[model samples]
Target: MNLALHSVSYAGVWPGQERLSLEEFIPRAAALGFKGVMLVAKRPHLSLLDYPSHQPEKRQALRALLAEHDLSVHSLAGYNDFTVGPERPDVPFWEHQIVYIAELAALAHDLDCPAIRIFTGYNRDGLSYDAGWTSVVTGLQEAARLVADFGVVLTVQNHHDIAVDYESMYQLLSEVDHPNCRAAFDAWSPAVQGLHGNELAAAVRRMAPFTAYTTVADYVALPRYRYEPALVNYVEEPARMLGVPLGEGLIDYGTFFDTLIETGYTGTVAYEMCSSLRDGGNLDSLDAYARQFQDYMSPYVAKANAGVAAATAR
Candidate 1:
Protein backbone atom coordinates (compact mmCIF):
# COMPACT_ATOMS: atom_id res chain seq x y z
CA MET A 1 0.00 0.00 0.00
CA ASN A 2 1.10 3.57 -0.68
CA LEU A 3 1.69 6.04 2.19
CA ALA A 4 0.71 9.68 1.87
CA LEU A 5 0.80 12.90 4.00
CA HIS A 6 -2.37 14.74 4.83
CA SER A 7 -1.95 18.51 5.04
CA VAL A 8 -4.11 18.68 8.15
CA SER A 9 -0.97 18.19 10.20
CA TYR A 10 -0.06 21.72 9.29
CA ALA A 11 -3.61 22.98 9.70
CA GLY A 12 -2.79 26.42 11.12
CA VAL A 13 0.46 27.26 9.35
CA TRP A 14 0.11 30.47 7.40
CA PRO A 15 0.71 30.97 3.68
CA GLY A 16 4.41 31.89 3.95
CA GLN A 17 5.67 28.88 5.89
CA GLU A 18 4.37 25.44 4.98
CA ARG A 19 1.89 24.62 2.23
CA LEU A 20 0.68 27.77 0.56
CA SER A 21 2.04 26.34 -2.67
CA LEU A 22 3.23 22.94 -3.87
CA GLU A 23 6.77 24.32 -3.72
CA GLU A 24 6.44 24.77 0.03
CA PHE A 25 5.58 21.14 0.79
CA ILE A 26 6.14 18.74 -2.14
CA PRO A 27 9.92 18.57 -1.90
CA ARG A 28 9.76 17.98 1.84
CA ALA A 29 7.23 15.19 1.51
CA ALA A 30 9.22 13.64 -1.35
CA ALA A 31 12.45 13.66 0.62
CA LEU A 32 10.70 11.83 3.44
CA GLY A 33 9.53 9.28 0.79
CA PHE A 34 5.85 10.18 1.04
CA LYS A 35 4.05 9.17 -2.16
CA GLY A 36 1.88 12.29 -2.36
CA VAL A 37 0.24 15.17 -0.46
CA MET A 38 -3.43 15.28 0.54
CA LEU A 39 -3.94 18.83 -0.72
CA VAL A 40 -6.96 20.39 1.01
CA ALA A 41 -7.44 22.71 -1.98
CA LYS A 42 -8.28 25.65 0.27
CA ARG A 43 -7.73 29.37 0.65
CA PRO A 44 -4.23 31.01 0.85
CA HIS A 45 -2.69 27.67 -0.15
CA LEU A 46 -3.93 26.86 -3.65
CA SER A 47 -6.68 29.45 -3.31
CA LEU A 48 -8.88 26.70 -4.70
CA LEU A 49 -11.78 28.85 -3.60
CA ASP A 50 -10.90 31.20 -6.43
CA TYR A 51 -9.19 28.93 -8.95
CA PRO A 52 -10.74 29.46 -12.36
CA SER A 53 -12.61 26.30 -13.21
CA HIS A 54 -11.65 24.49 -16.43
CA GLN A 55 -9.20 27.23 -17.28
CA PRO A 56 -6.26 26.07 -19.42
CA GLU A 57 -3.76 28.48 -17.92
CA LYS A 58 -4.46 27.37 -14.35
CA ARG A 59 -4.38 23.66 -15.26
CA GLN A 60 -1.00 24.02 -16.95
CA ALA A 61 0.38 25.90 -13.95
CA LEU A 62 -0.82 23.20 -11.54
CA ARG A 63 0.61 20.39 -13.64
CA ALA A 64 3.93 22.17 -13.91
CA LEU A 65 4.09 22.65 -10.13
CA LEU A 66 3.51 18.93 -9.48
CA ALA A 67 6.14 17.98 -12.05
CA GLU A 68 8.69 20.36 -10.53
CA HIS A 69 8.65 18.52 -7.20
CA ASP A 70 8.02 14.97 -8.45
CA LEU A 71 4.65 15.04 -6.73
CA SER A 72 0.93 14.69 -7.44
CA VAL A 73 -2.30 15.48 -5.60
CA HIS A 74 -3.52 12.43 -3.69
CA SER A 75 -6.97 13.72 -2.82
CA LEU A 76 -8.45 17.06 -1.94
CA ALA A 77 -9.72 17.30 1.67
CA GLY A 78 -12.85 18.99 0.22
CA TYR A 79 -14.46 19.23 3.67
CA ASN A 80 -18.03 20.11 2.72
CA ASP A 81 -21.19 19.63 4.78
CA PHE A 82 -19.13 17.81 7.37
CA THR A 83 -20.19 19.19 10.73
CA VAL A 84 -23.63 20.62 10.10
CA GLY A 85 -24.03 20.27 13.84
CA PRO A 86 -27.43 19.14 15.04
CA GLU A 87 -29.47 21.64 13.08
CA ARG A 88 -32.70 20.89 11.24
CA PRO A 89 -31.92 20.59 7.53
CA ASP A 90 -32.57 23.63 5.38
CA VAL A 91 -34.05 22.74 2.02
CA PRO A 92 -32.61 25.80 0.27
CA PHE A 93 -29.17 25.51 1.86
CA TRP A 94 -29.12 21.81 1.11
CA GLU A 95 -29.76 22.53 -2.55
CA HIS A 96 -26.97 25.08 -2.53
CA GLN A 97 -24.67 22.50 -0.96
CA ILE A 98 -25.42 20.21 -3.91
CA VAL A 99 -24.22 22.88 -6.31
CA TYR A 100 -21.07 23.37 -4.22
CA ILE A 101 -20.32 19.65 -4.35
CA ALA A 102 -20.86 19.58 -8.09
CA GLU A 103 -18.25 22.28 -8.54
CA LEU A 104 -15.83 20.36 -6.33
CA ALA A 105 -16.58 17.22 -8.37
CA ALA A 106 -15.75 19.06 -11.57
CA LEU A 107 -12.51 20.30 -10.06
CA ALA A 108 -11.62 16.81 -8.85
CA HIS A 109 -12.20 15.47 -12.33
CA ASP A 110 -9.91 18.10 -13.81
CA LEU A 111 -7.17 17.33 -11.30
CA ASP A 112 -7.45 13.56 -11.91
CA CYS A 113 -8.19 12.78 -8.27
CA PRO A 114 -10.08 9.46 -8.15
CA ALA A 115 -11.94 10.20 -4.92
CA ILE A 116 -13.33 13.06 -2.82
CA ARG A 117 -13.49 13.12 0.99
CA ILE A 118 -16.75 14.00 2.76
CA PHE A 119 -17.88 13.81 6.40
CA THR A 120 -21.19 12.36 7.61
CA GLY A 121 -22.71 15.33 9.47
CA TYR A 122 -24.44 16.07 12.80
CA ASN A 123 -27.98 15.92 14.16
CA ARG A 124 -30.12 19.02 13.91
CA ASP A 125 -31.02 20.52 17.29
CA GLY A 126 -34.45 19.48 18.56
CA LEU A 127 -34.75 17.35 15.42
CA SER A 128 -35.41 13.67 15.91
CA TYR A 129 -32.42 11.45 15.24
CA ASP A 130 -34.34 9.71 12.46
CA ALA A 131 -35.03 12.90 10.49
CA GLY A 132 -31.50 14.27 10.88
CA TRP A 133 -29.91 11.04 9.70
CA THR A 134 -32.21 10.92 6.71
CA SER A 135 -31.38 14.45 5.68
CA VAL A 136 -27.63 13.86 6.00
CA VAL A 137 -27.87 10.76 3.84
CA THR A 138 -29.94 12.52 1.20
CA GLY A 139 -27.44 15.39 1.04
CA LEU A 140 -24.56 12.98 0.42
CA GLN A 141 -26.58 11.05 -2.15
CA GLU A 142 -27.04 14.17 -4.21
CA ALA A 143 -23.29 14.72 -4.15
CA ALA A 144 -22.82 11.09 -5.15
CA ARG A 145 -25.10 11.45 -8.15
CA LEU A 146 -23.25 14.49 -9.47
CA VAL A 147 -19.93 12.66 -9.52
CA ALA A 148 -21.13 9.21 -10.63
CA ASP A 149 -20.98 10.08 -14.32
CA PHE A 150 -17.27 10.86 -14.11
CA GLY A 151 -16.36 7.66 -12.24
CA VAL A 152 -15.25 9.60 -9.18
CA VAL A 153 -15.88 8.13 -5.74
CA LEU A 154 -16.96 9.91 -2.56
CA THR A 155 -15.10 8.62 0.52
CA VAL A 156 -16.63 9.82 3.80
CA GLN A 157 -14.50 10.21 6.92
CA ASN A 158 -15.78 8.75 10.22
CA HIS A 159 -15.85 11.89 12.33
CA HIS A 160 -17.72 11.57 15.62
CA ASP A 161 -20.90 13.57 16.51
CA ILE A 162 -22.64 12.76 13.20
CA ALA A 163 -21.08 9.39 12.39
CA VAL A 164 -20.77 8.59 16.08
CA ASP A 165 -20.36 4.81 15.70
CA TYR A 166 -19.62 2.02 13.27
CA GLU A 167 -23.28 1.06 13.01
CA SER A 168 -24.20 4.68 12.35
CA MET A 169 -21.56 4.78 9.62
CA TYR A 170 -23.06 1.66 8.08
CA GLN A 171 -26.45 3.37 8.11
CA LEU A 172 -25.08 6.46 6.36
CA LEU A 173 -23.32 4.44 3.69
CA SER A 174 -26.44 2.33 3.24
CA GLU A 175 -28.45 5.44 2.57
CA VAL A 176 -26.09 6.53 -0.18
CA ASP A 177 -26.17 2.93 -1.41
CA HIS A 178 -24.09 3.26 -4.52
CA PRO A 179 -20.90 1.45 -5.43
CA ASN A 180 -19.10 4.74 -5.89
CA CYS A 181 -20.08 5.80 -2.38
CA ARG A 182 -17.53 4.57 0.21
CA ALA A 183 -15.77 4.92 3.54
CA ALA A 184 -12.57 6.74 4.52
CA PHE A 185 -12.11 5.02 7.87
CA ASP A 186 -10.33 6.85 10.68
CA ALA A 187 -8.57 4.44 13.08
CA TRP A 188 -10.14 5.46 16.38
CA SER A 189 -13.74 6.48 15.71
CA PRO A 190 -15.16 2.97 16.04
CA ALA A 191 -13.46 2.47 19.36
CA VAL A 192 -14.58 5.90 20.53
CA GLN A 193 -18.16 4.82 20.01
CA GLY A 194 -17.63 1.62 22.04
CA LEU A 195 -17.73 -1.11 19.37
CA HIS A 196 -15.88 -4.34 20.02
CA GLY A 197 -12.49 -4.30 18.31
CA ASN A 198 -13.40 -7.35 16.25
CA GLU A 199 -16.71 -5.76 15.35
CA LEU A 200 -14.92 -2.60 14.30
CA ALA A 201 -12.52 -4.58 12.18
CA ALA A 202 -15.44 -6.37 10.62
CA ALA A 203 -17.08 -3.05 9.81
CA VAL A 204 -13.92 -2.07 7.97
CA ARG A 205 -14.01 -5.26 5.96
CA ARG A 206 -17.60 -4.52 5.03
CA MET A 207 -16.40 -1.17 3.74
CA ALA A 208 -13.59 -2.88 1.81
CA PRO A 209 -15.56 -3.15 -1.40
CA PHE A 210 -16.21 0.58 -1.13
CA THR A 211 -13.24 1.77 0.99
CA ALA A 212 -11.13 3.94 -1.26
CA TYR A 213 -8.88 5.41 1.44
CA THR A 214 -7.88 4.85 5.07
CA THR A 215 -6.50 7.41 7.59
CA VAL A 216 -4.34 6.26 10.57
CA ALA A 217 -3.39 7.88 13.89
CA ASP A 218 -3.27 6.92 17.58
CA TYR A 219 -5.25 8.71 20.32
CA VAL A 220 -4.32 9.12 23.97
CA ALA A 221 -6.81 9.77 26.73
CA LEU A 222 -6.15 13.00 28.61
CA PRO A 223 -3.92 12.81 31.65
CA ARG A 224 -6.16 13.33 34.70
CA TYR A 225 -4.88 16.79 35.52
CA ARG A 226 -6.74 19.97 36.31
CA TYR A 227 -6.05 21.22 32.81
CA GLU A 228 -4.61 19.68 29.62
CA PRO A 229 -1.02 20.02 28.51
CA ALA A 230 -0.55 22.48 25.69
CA LEU A 231 -0.06 20.94 22.29
CA VAL A 232 -0.78 24.15 20.48
CA ASN A 233 -0.24 26.51 23.39
CA TYR A 234 0.71 29.25 21.01
CA VAL A 235 -2.94 29.43 20.06
CA GLU A 236 -3.56 30.82 23.58
CA GLU A 237 -6.56 28.54 23.86
CA PRO A 238 -6.26 25.36 21.79
CA ALA A 239 -8.75 22.70 21.00
CA ARG A 240 -8.58 19.48 22.99
CA MET A 241 -6.42 17.51 20.57
CA LEU A 242 -5.63 13.99 21.85
CA GLY A 243 -3.26 12.10 19.54
CA VAL A 244 0.44 12.51 18.90
CA PRO A 245 3.67 10.70 17.74
CA LEU A 246 2.76 7.48 15.88
CA GLY A 247 3.64 4.79 18.41
CA GLU A 248 3.55 7.06 21.45
CA GLY A 249 -0.11 7.74 20.90
CA LEU A 250 -2.89 5.50 22.29
CA ILE A 251 -4.11 3.94 19.03
CA ASP A 252 -2.23 0.74 18.27
CA TYR A 253 -0.27 1.13 15.05
CA GLY A 254 0.98 -2.47 14.92
CA THR A 255 -2.48 -3.97 15.30
CA PHE A 256 -4.07 -1.48 12.93
CA PHE A 257 -1.54 -2.26 10.20
CA ASP A 258 -2.17 -5.96 10.71
CA THR A 259 -5.85 -5.31 10.18
CA LEU A 260 -5.09 -3.40 6.97
CA ILE A 261 -3.19 -6.41 5.69
CA GLU A 262 -6.03 -8.75 6.66
CA THR A 263 -8.42 -6.62 4.66
CA GLY A 264 -6.04 -6.50 1.66
CA TYR A 265 -6.14 -2.73 1.56
CA THR A 266 -3.85 -1.33 -1.17
CA GLY A 267 -4.84 2.30 -1.24
CA THR A 268 -2.99 5.22 0.35
CA VAL A 269 -2.39 4.89 4.11
CA ALA A 270 -2.37 8.52 5.20
CA TYR A 271 -0.67 10.02 8.29
CA GLU A 272 -2.92 12.61 9.93
CA MET A 273 -1.95 14.62 13.03
CA CYS A 274 -3.15 17.98 14.26
CA SER A 275 -0.80 18.35 17.20
CA SER A 276 2.19 19.58 15.21
CA LEU A 277 0.34 22.39 13.43
CA ARG A 278 1.21 24.97 16.07
CA ASP A 279 3.82 27.74 16.14
CA GLY A 280 6.63 25.95 17.96
CA GLY A 281 6.68 22.44 16.43
CA ASN A 282 9.67 23.40 14.21
CA LEU A 283 7.96 21.51 11.35
CA ASP A 284 8.77 24.12 8.77
CA SER A 285 12.39 23.05 9.04
CA LEU A 286 11.02 20.31 6.78
CA ASP A 287 13.65 17.53 6.88
CA ALA A 288 13.77 17.48 10.67
CA TYR A 289 10.05 17.09 11.31
CA ALA A 290 9.05 14.94 8.32
CA ARG A 291 12.02 12.63 8.81
CA GLN A 292 10.97 12.13 12.42
CA PHE A 293 7.54 11.17 11.13
CA GLN A 294 9.05 8.88 8.51
CA ASP A 295 11.20 7.22 11.14
CA TYR A 296 8.10 6.47 13.20
CA MET A 297 6.26 4.99 10.22
CA SER A 298 9.15 3.15 8.49
CA PRO A 299 9.24 0.17 10.82
CA TYR A 300 5.50 -0.37 10.55
CA VAL A 301 5.66 -0.31 6.75
CA ALA A 302 8.64 -2.66 6.74
CA LYS A 303 6.81 -5.10 8.98
CA ALA A 304 3.84 -5.00 6.63
CA ASN A 305 6.04 -5.68 3.61
CA ALA A 306 7.69 -8.62 5.34
CA GLY A 307 4.29 -10.12 6.07
CA VAL A 308 3.35 -9.77 2.40
CA ALA A 309 6.60 -11.40 1.36
CA ALA A 310 6.02 -14.31 3.72
CA ALA A 311 2.52 -14.85 2.35
CA THR A 312 3.79 -14.69 -1.22
CA ALA A 313 6.44 -17.31 -0.42
CA ARG A 314 3.63 -19.71 0.41
Candidate 2:
Protein backbone atom coordinates (compact mmCIF):
# COMPACT_ATOMS: atom_id res chain seq x y z
CA MET A 1 0.00 0.00 0.00
CA ASN A 2 2.74 2.44 -0.86
CA LEU A 3 1.45 5.87 -1.98
CA ALA A 4 2.66 7.48 -5.18
CA LEU A 5 1.75 10.65 -7.04
CA HIS A 6 1.18 10.63 -10.80
CA SER A 7 3.21 13.07 -12.88
CA VAL A 8 0.14 13.90 -15.01
CA SER A 9 -1.27 15.92 -12.12
CA TYR A 10 1.37 18.56 -12.73
CA ALA A 11 2.08 17.90 -16.41
CA GLY A 12 -0.58 20.38 -17.56
CA VAL A 13 -2.32 17.75 -19.70
CA TRP A 14 -5.54 19.46 -18.74
CA PRO A 15 -6.13 23.12 -19.50
CA GLY A 16 -5.13 25.68 -16.84
CA GLN A 17 -2.76 23.26 -15.07
CA GLU A 18 0.83 24.33 -14.65
CA ARG A 19 3.33 21.92 -16.17
CA LEU A 20 6.50 20.50 -14.60
CA SER A 21 9.39 18.72 -16.21
CA LEU A 22 10.47 15.31 -14.92
CA GLU A 23 13.58 16.92 -13.47
CA GLU A 24 11.56 19.47 -11.52
CA PHE A 25 8.75 17.06 -10.73
CA ILE A 26 10.89 14.48 -8.94
CA PRO A 27 12.05 16.72 -6.11
CA ARG A 28 8.58 18.19 -5.68
CA ALA A 29 6.98 14.74 -5.43
CA ALA A 30 9.56 13.65 -2.88
CA ALA A 31 8.98 16.86 -0.95
CA LEU A 32 5.26 16.14 -0.89
CA GLY A 33 6.07 12.88 1.03
CA PHE A 34 5.31 10.38 -1.73
CA LYS A 35 7.19 7.07 -1.48
CA GLY A 36 7.38 6.89 -5.28
CA VAL A 37 5.91 8.38 -8.47
CA MET A 38 4.05 7.19 -11.54
CA LEU A 39 5.41 9.04 -14.55
CA VAL A 40 3.36 9.82 -17.66
CA ALA A 41 5.46 8.30 -20.47
CA LYS A 42 5.08 11.07 -23.03
CA ARG A 43 6.02 14.61 -23.95
CA PRO A 44 6.80 17.15 -21.22
CA HIS A 45 7.95 14.12 -19.24
CA LEU A 46 9.49 10.75 -20.23
CA SER A 47 8.52 10.52 -23.90
CA LEU A 48 10.04 7.66 -25.90
CA LEU A 49 11.43 10.19 -28.34
CA ASP A 50 13.41 11.75 -25.51
CA TYR A 51 14.50 8.51 -23.86
CA PRO A 52 14.68 6.04 -26.69
CA SER A 53 15.91 2.51 -26.11
CA HIS A 54 19.11 3.32 -28.00
CA GLN A 55 19.81 6.19 -25.59
CA PRO A 56 20.92 4.43 -22.45
CA GLU A 57 22.51 7.63 -21.17
CA LYS A 58 19.16 9.43 -20.98
CA ARG A 59 17.63 6.57 -19.04
CA GLN A 60 20.57 6.40 -16.66
CA ALA A 61 20.38 10.14 -16.07
CA LEU A 62 16.70 9.93 -15.26
CA ARG A 63 17.32 7.01 -12.92
CA ALA A 64 20.07 8.91 -11.15
CA LEU A 65 17.76 11.91 -10.81
CA LEU A 66 15.08 9.86 -9.07
CA ALA A 67 17.67 8.25 -6.81
CA GLU A 68 18.97 11.69 -5.91
CA HIS A 69 15.65 12.44 -4.28
CA ASP A 70 15.49 8.99 -2.67
CA LEU A 71 12.39 8.22 -4.72
CA SER A 72 11.42 5.26 -6.86
CA VAL A 73 9.39 5.12 -10.07
CA HIS A 74 6.34 3.05 -9.24
CA SER A 75 5.27 2.75 -12.86
CA LEU A 76 5.39 4.35 -16.28
CA ALA A 77 2.02 5.33 -17.78
CA GLY A 78 1.71 4.76 -21.55
CA TYR A 79 -1.00 5.81 -24.02
CA ASN A 80 -2.11 3.45 -26.79
CA ASP A 81 -5.28 2.28 -28.51
CA PHE A 82 -5.21 -1.21 -30.04
CA THR A 83 -8.22 -0.49 -32.27
CA VAL A 84 -6.89 2.71 -33.78
CA GLY A 85 -6.89 2.85 -37.59
CA PRO A 86 -9.58 0.20 -37.95
CA GLU A 87 -10.16 1.48 -41.50
CA ARG A 88 -6.46 1.59 -42.37
CA PRO A 89 -5.53 -2.05 -42.05
CA ASP A 90 -2.39 -1.55 -44.13
CA VAL A 91 -0.97 1.06 -41.73
CA PRO A 92 0.28 -1.45 -39.14
CA PHE A 93 -1.02 0.69 -36.25
CA TRP A 94 -1.08 -2.23 -33.83
CA GLU A 95 2.49 -3.12 -34.65
CA HIS A 96 3.50 0.50 -34.09
CA GLN A 97 1.83 0.49 -30.68
CA ILE A 98 3.51 -2.77 -29.78
CA VAL A 99 6.88 -1.33 -30.68
CA TYR A 100 6.10 1.81 -28.68
CA ILE A 101 5.31 -0.30 -25.64
CA ALA A 102 8.39 -2.39 -26.19
CA GLU A 103 10.50 0.73 -26.05
CA LEU A 104 8.72 1.91 -22.93
CA ALA A 105 9.35 -1.48 -21.41
CA ALA A 106 13.04 -1.10 -22.08
CA LEU A 107 12.94 2.35 -20.52
CA ALA A 108 11.11 1.07 -17.49
CA HIS A 109 13.64 -1.69 -17.01
CA ASP A 110 16.44 0.85 -17.08
CA LEU A 111 14.63 3.04 -14.58
CA ASP A 112 13.98 0.06 -12.31
CA CYS A 113 10.24 0.45 -12.59
CA PRO A 114 8.44 -2.86 -12.31
CA ALA A 115 5.34 -2.06 -14.40
CA ILE A 116 4.00 0.07 -17.27
CA ARG A 117 0.34 1.10 -17.32
CA ILE A 118 -1.48 0.86 -20.67
CA PHE A 119 -5.04 0.89 -21.98
CA THR A 120 -7.18 -1.26 -24.23
CA GLY A 121 -8.62 0.23 -27.42
CA TYR A 122 -11.61 2.53 -27.62
CA ASN A 123 -14.61 1.29 -29.59
CA ARG A 124 -14.43 2.34 -33.21
CA ASP A 125 -17.42 2.96 -35.44
CA GLY A 126 -18.11 0.03 -37.79
CA LEU A 127 -15.98 -2.24 -35.59
CA SER A 128 -17.87 -5.01 -33.84
CA TYR A 129 -17.51 -5.29 -30.06
CA ASP A 130 -16.10 -8.77 -30.44
CA ALA A 131 -13.54 -7.54 -32.94
CA GLY A 132 -12.40 -4.78 -30.60
CA TRP A 133 -12.19 -7.21 -27.71
CA THR A 134 -10.12 -9.70 -29.70
CA SER A 135 -7.81 -6.96 -30.93
CA VAL A 136 -7.12 -5.84 -27.37
CA VAL A 137 -6.62 -9.36 -26.07
CA THR A 138 -4.22 -10.33 -28.84
CA GLY A 139 -2.45 -6.97 -28.74
CA LEU A 140 -1.88 -7.29 -25.01
CA GLN A 141 -0.61 -10.84 -25.45
CA GLU A 142 1.94 -9.69 -28.00
CA ALA A 143 2.93 -6.68 -25.91
CA ALA A 144 3.35 -8.85 -22.87
CA ARG A 145 5.58 -11.22 -24.76
CA LEU A 146 7.65 -8.35 -26.12
CA VAL A 147 8.26 -6.93 -22.63
CA ALA A 148 8.75 -10.23 -20.87
CA ASP A 149 12.44 -10.39 -21.78
CA PHE A 150 12.87 -6.93 -20.23
CA GLY A 151 11.36 -8.15 -16.96
CA VAL A 152 8.69 -5.46 -17.13
CA VAL A 153 5.04 -6.28 -16.60
CA LEU A 154 2.36 -4.71 -18.78
CA THR A 155 -0.56 -3.49 -16.65
CA VAL A 156 -3.77 -2.92 -18.58
CA GLN A 157 -5.79 -0.28 -16.82
CA ASN A 158 -9.58 -0.50 -16.64
CA HIS A 159 -9.78 2.39 -19.03
CA HIS A 160 -10.68 2.96 -22.67
CA ASP A 161 -13.92 1.43 -23.95
CA ILE A 162 -12.84 -2.13 -24.67
CA ALA A 163 -12.98 -3.54 -21.12
CA VAL A 164 -13.63 -0.76 -18.60
CA ASP A 165 -15.90 -2.59 -16.19
CA TYR A 166 -14.28 -4.71 -13.49
CA GLU A 167 -15.90 -7.91 -14.80
CA SER A 168 -14.84 -7.21 -18.37
CA MET A 169 -11.34 -6.28 -17.26
CA TYR A 170 -11.03 -9.59 -15.47
CA GLN A 171 -12.18 -11.40 -18.60
CA LEU A 172 -9.76 -9.45 -20.77
CA LEU A 173 -6.82 -10.38 -18.54
CA SER A 174 -7.91 -14.01 -18.39
CA GLU A 175 -8.14 -14.18 -22.17
CA VAL A 176 -4.81 -12.48 -22.69
CA ASP A 177 -3.44 -15.22 -20.45
CA HIS A 178 0.06 -13.84 -20.33
CA PRO A 179 2.14 -13.96 -17.19
CA ASN A 180 3.39 -10.42 -17.77
CA CYS A 181 -0.05 -8.93 -18.32
CA ARG A 182 -1.93 -7.77 -15.20
CA ALA A 183 -4.57 -5.28 -14.04
CA ALA A 184 -4.15 -1.60 -13.12
CA PHE A 185 -7.57 -1.05 -11.59
CA ASP A 186 -8.73 2.38 -10.47
CA ALA A 187 -11.53 3.64 -8.20
CA TRP A 188 -12.69 6.56 -10.36
CA SER A 189 -14.37 4.51 -13.10
CA PRO A 190 -16.26 2.23 -10.73
CA ALA A 191 -17.34 5.21 -8.65
CA VAL A 192 -18.62 7.05 -11.73
CA GLN A 193 -20.54 3.94 -12.76
CA GLY A 194 -22.52 4.14 -9.46
CA LEU A 195 -20.72 1.33 -7.66
CA HIS A 196 -20.64 1.86 -3.91
CA GLY A 197 -20.69 0.06 -0.57
CA ASN A 198 -21.10 -3.67 -1.12
CA GLU A 199 -21.05 -3.46 -4.91
CA LEU A 200 -17.77 -1.56 -4.99
CA ALA A 201 -16.31 -3.96 -2.46
CA ALA A 202 -17.30 -6.90 -4.64
CA ALA A 203 -15.67 -5.35 -7.70
CA VAL A 204 -12.41 -4.69 -5.86
CA ARG A 205 -12.32 -8.18 -4.41
CA ARG A 206 -12.90 -9.73 -7.84
CA MET A 207 -10.08 -7.77 -9.47
CA ALA A 208 -7.67 -7.90 -6.53
CA PRO A 209 -5.94 -11.12 -7.52
CA PHE A 210 -5.03 -9.86 -11.00
CA THR A 211 -4.46 -6.25 -10.05
CA ALA A 212 -0.78 -5.24 -9.98
CA TYR A 213 -1.47 -1.52 -9.57
CA THR A 214 -4.17 1.13 -9.06
CA THR A 215 -4.63 4.90 -9.37
CA VAL A 216 -6.80 7.20 -7.21
CA ALA A 217 -8.53 10.41 -8.18
CA ASP A 218 -11.65 12.11 -6.87
CA TYR A 219 -14.29 13.94 -8.91
CA VAL A 220 -17.68 15.64 -8.59
CA ALA A 221 -20.21 15.34 -11.42
CA LEU A 222 -21.57 18.52 -12.96
CA PRO A 223 -24.95 18.01 -14.56
CA ARG A 224 -25.43 19.47 -18.02
CA TYR A 225 -28.45 20.64 -20.04
CA ARG A 226 -29.03 21.61 -23.63
CA TYR A 227 -31.45 24.29 -24.75
CA GLU A 228 -34.15 23.06 -27.15
CA PRO A 229 -35.53 26.21 -28.67
CA ALA A 230 -38.26 24.40 -30.60
CA LEU A 231 -39.65 22.85 -27.43
CA VAL A 232 -38.76 25.87 -25.31
CA ASN A 233 -37.18 23.60 -22.73
CA TYR A 234 -33.80 22.31 -21.66
CA VAL A 235 -32.84 18.78 -22.52
CA GLU A 236 -30.81 16.88 -19.98
CA GLU A 237 -27.35 15.86 -21.16
CA PRO A 238 -24.71 13.65 -19.62
CA ALA A 239 -22.96 15.12 -16.62
CA ARG A 240 -19.40 16.43 -16.90
CA MET A 241 -17.06 15.13 -14.21
CA LEU A 242 -14.70 17.61 -12.61
CA GLY A 243 -11.70 16.45 -10.57
CA VAL A 244 -11.53 17.33 -6.86
CA PRO A 245 -9.34 16.69 -3.86
CA LEU A 246 -9.33 13.17 -2.41
CA GLY A 247 -12.18 12.36 0.05
CA GLU A 248 -14.14 15.42 -1.15
CA GLY A 249 -15.69 13.89 -4.25
CA LEU A 250 -18.03 11.05 -5.24
CA ILE A 251 -15.44 8.23 -4.91
CA ASP A 252 -15.64 6.02 -1.83
CA TYR A 253 -11.93 5.30 -1.39
CA GLY A 254 -12.63 4.14 2.15
CA THR A 255 -14.39 1.07 0.83
CA PHE A 256 -11.99 0.83 -2.06
CA PHE A 257 -8.90 0.65 0.17
CA ASP A 258 -10.55 -1.56 2.74
CA THR A 259 -11.31 -4.19 0.12
CA LEU A 260 -7.84 -3.85 -1.34
CA ILE A 261 -6.23 -4.52 2.02
CA GLU A 262 -8.59 -7.32 2.95
CA THR A 263 -7.69 -9.00 -0.33
CA GLY A 264 -3.93 -8.67 0.40
CA TYR A 265 -3.22 -6.09 -2.30
CA THR A 266 0.21 -4.61 -1.46
CA GLY A 267 0.48 -2.72 -4.75
CA THR A 268 1.09 0.97 -5.33
CA VAL A 269 -1.84 3.41 -5.12
CA ALA A 270 -1.18 6.48 -7.28
CA TYR A 271 -3.03 9.78 -6.98
CA GLU A 272 -3.63 11.66 -10.21
CA MET A 273 -5.47 14.85 -11.02
CA CYS A 274 -5.70 14.07 -14.69
CA SER A 275 -8.59 16.33 -15.63
CA SER A 276 -9.79 19.92 -15.16
CA LEU A 277 -9.82 20.26 -11.38
CA ARG A 278 -12.44 22.11 -9.31
CA ASP A 279 -10.05 24.90 -8.45
CA GLY A 280 -7.93 26.35 -11.25
CA GLY A 281 -4.92 24.12 -12.02
CA ASN A 282 -2.28 26.57 -11.02
CA LEU A 283 0.90 25.35 -9.35
CA ASP A 284 -0.52 26.20 -5.95
CA SER A 285 -3.76 24.35 -6.60
CA LEU A 286 -1.93 21.32 -7.99
CA ASP A 287 0.41 21.22 -4.99
CA ALA A 288 -2.48 21.53 -2.59
CA TYR A 289 -4.37 18.72 -4.28
CA ALA A 290 -1.32 16.46 -4.19
CA ARG A 291 -0.77 17.25 -0.54
CA GLN A 292 -4.41 16.55 0.23
CA PHE A 293 -3.98 13.02 -1.11
CA GLN A 294 -1.00 12.53 1.17
CA ASP A 295 -2.94 13.86 4.12
CA TYR A 296 -5.96 11.71 3.39
CA MET A 297 -4.29 8.38 2.52
CA SER A 298 -1.57 8.47 5.16
CA PRO A 299 -3.79 6.92 7.76
CA TYR A 300 -5.13 4.20 5.49
CA VAL A 301 -1.64 3.22 4.32
CA ALA A 302 -0.35 3.28 7.86
CA LYS A 303 -3.12 1.01 9.05
CA ALA A 304 -2.59 -1.43 6.20
CA ASN A 305 1.13 -1.59 6.89
CA ALA A 306 0.55 -2.13 10.58
CA GLY A 307 -1.78 -5.02 9.88
CA VAL A 308 0.83 -6.67 7.68
CA ALA A 309 3.46 -6.22 10.36
CA ALA A 310 1.20 -7.65 13.02
CA ALA A 311 0.36 -10.67 10.87
CA THR A 312 4.03 -11.31 10.17
CA ALA A 313 4.79 -11.10 13.90
CA ARG A 314 2.15 -13.72 14.60
The C-alpha local distance difference test score for the whole of candidate 1 amounts to: 0.66
Model 2, residue 35: what's the lDDT? 71
Could you tally the backbone clashes for each prediction? 4, 0
Worst 10 residues of 1 by lDDT: 232-241
The C-alpha TM-scores of every prediction are 0.80, 0.98
Q: Which residue pairs show collisions in model 2?
A: none
Q: Residue 226 in candidate 2 has what lDDT?
A: 100
- In the range 210-253, model 1's lDDT, one tens digit per residue, is 67787766555653334335753332332244545566655555
Q: Clash pairs of candidate 1? A: 86-123, 86-124, 86-125, 87-124
- Assess candidate 2 and give its lDDT: 0.92
Point to the candidate with the largest TM-score.
2
